[model samples]
Target: MSIPNEALQKILQEIGQKKAFAEQQLAIVKQQMAVKTRENRMLQLTASEVDSLPGDTNVYEGVGKMFVCTPIPDVQKRIASESEEINADMSNLQKKQDYLEKTYENSKQSLEQVLRGGGS
Candidate 1:
């Protein structure tokens, strides 16, 4: 027997909601990647500029919106460590994005089938 109209509608609605959620999550992941990329670039630029500067350089690091005098070596180390972390995070986000896209595609196909009077 065919599914009831109300039940089919409910299923379709739920599928639509899930698809929207997946899209939103995908957007968030893309934005995060952009932000991480920018941060990585900034770190590279800062390191290069620091290298060009004369020795015994004094720099101030922003800590909770306050600049504190810090040694150059420490700042460089921090930048190196954070870049590695961001790289790992980017890889993880890429995997998550791939999974979300696959799920969304499967859901979309099911929704289409249901709309065409086929079982979801």
Candidate 2:
């Protein structure tokens, strides 16, 4: 059975939209991943620097524009916790990126099939 030209056009349009949407979502995910990765790296570096400091050294954590003197151990713990959270966020973003990539590919394939008259 042959599918009507109108139906084919509609299917193509829908698939194209899906492909575009997925592409946009993928870009967003990539940007988020980049941000998280940078944050994680900064945390790692900060942790390293803090570790090199003497145990009695005073550390200050920025709070809105002013720095408040904080204990070394508290600073270390805070850095560790922030690093873990950033890593987890990056992992989740990676998963989302993978899923979006697959979705975009599938949409592209479907669009191709429809264009080639194989979708009927």
Per-candidate clashes come to: 0, 0
Q: Once model 2 is optimally superposed onto the true structure by TM-score, how far is the C-alpha of residue 100 displaced, in angstroms? A: 0.4
Give the lDDT of residue 103 in candidate 2.
Answer: 98
Residue pairs of candidate 1 with colliding backbone atoms = none
Name the lDDT of candidate 2.
0.89
Give one digit per residue, the lDDT tens place, for model 2 in 1-120: 777888877888899999999999999999998888888889889999999999988888899989999998999889989988998898899899999999999999888777777454
Structural similarity to truth (TM-score) of each candidate: 0.85, 0.94
Tens-digit per-residue lDDT, 61-112, candidate 1: 8889799988888888998998899899999999999999987898899899
How big is the positional error of residue 56 in model 2, measured in Å on the Cα after superposition?
0.8
Leading candidate by lDDT: 2
Residue 72 local lDDT, model 2: 89
